[model samples]
Target: MLSIIYYFVFNIFIGDYIKYSCIVPADASFQVYRDNFIFFVKVFYYFRYFLFCFIIVIRLFYVKNKFFRWLIKKICYFA
Candidate 1:
């Protein structure tokens, strides 16, 4: 169940990345960039961007929730 959730999160992030990356670049270079790689390579290249997004989500969640902060503190204190 947790893995499924993570997969959905990653899928959403990757979809957004491809959507914005393709639309945001106006130059021929972007086409060249896309053409230079095969499909799997492109997905592999975007994995780091996904990790970056995951970190940002975690950071934002951590900042927004007092419960999460307290939970982390207790875990650390107990550990």
Candidate 2:
């Protein structure tokens, strides 16, 4: 779907799209940077994979078109 493709593309170029600002507090410790990196990795992992798949499955299940749902189910079974 276009949503999946767009999200994947966004993830691919996110590193370039987002720039690191060099502002820091004087009292901030090194652990803050490590924590931020961990959070970033978690977001990248969950958003690109789990989050969208969950949304799509929920949307498909809620659709009123039985034929379309059946088609997707068949395709997913083989995929």
Candidate 3:
């Protein structure tokens, strides 16, 4: 429920961002930035999952680098 509301608000914000950022009117705006928007949307979704993999890579790196492993354990102590 909360996440749904957040998406609703985020969508409104994105709409306003695209609206004021472009010189074109809302109706023709889609045609104006179609290809560019599609490319960025794809890259955005691609990196969404990439971020998770990047975090796993960080953990993997710590497993091999004993110095960073201890440093994080001491500085980033958590439950």
Candidate 4:
């Protein structure tokens, strides 16, 4: 829902650049940019998910033992 609104607002602001230029407003270029933007967004979404999962996993490990704390410390040291 938010993305749809963003797309509309974004196009409203930027559409003229593409529409008025010598470049053809063909479906191929539109789809290419659309797919690239979607892929970039998805990558960030997955990264956030991965970070959330990592935090949860670390929390669980911390709950398990002092050894896990040491392990995390070591990992952080190298990280």
Candidate 1 TM-score over all chains jointly: 0.31
Model 2 spans with C-alpha error above 4 angstroms? 1-18, 21-46
TM-score of each: 0.31, 0.39, 0.38, 0.47
Order by lDDT, highest first: 2, 1, 4, 3
> Candidate 1, which segments miss by more than 4 Å at Cα?
36-79
Judged by lDDT, which candidate is best? 2
Write down the TM-score for model 2. 0.39
Model 1 per-residue lDDT tens digits across residues 7-79:
6766666566555665646577777766544364557557757876766656756686888877766765897
Q: Return the TM-score for candidate 4, rounded to 2 decimals.
A: 0.47
Give a tens-digit lDDT track for model 3, residues 1-79. 8546545544555555455555544575576576576455555545535665666657766687788777767755672
lDDT of 4 by residue, 1-39 (tens): 855764554445345443443353448758777666556
Local lDDT at 27 for model 2: 47
lDDT of every predicted structure (CA atoms):
0.64, 0.65, 0.59, 0.60
Residue-wise lDDT of candidate 2 within 36-56, one digit each (tens)?
765775576556667668778
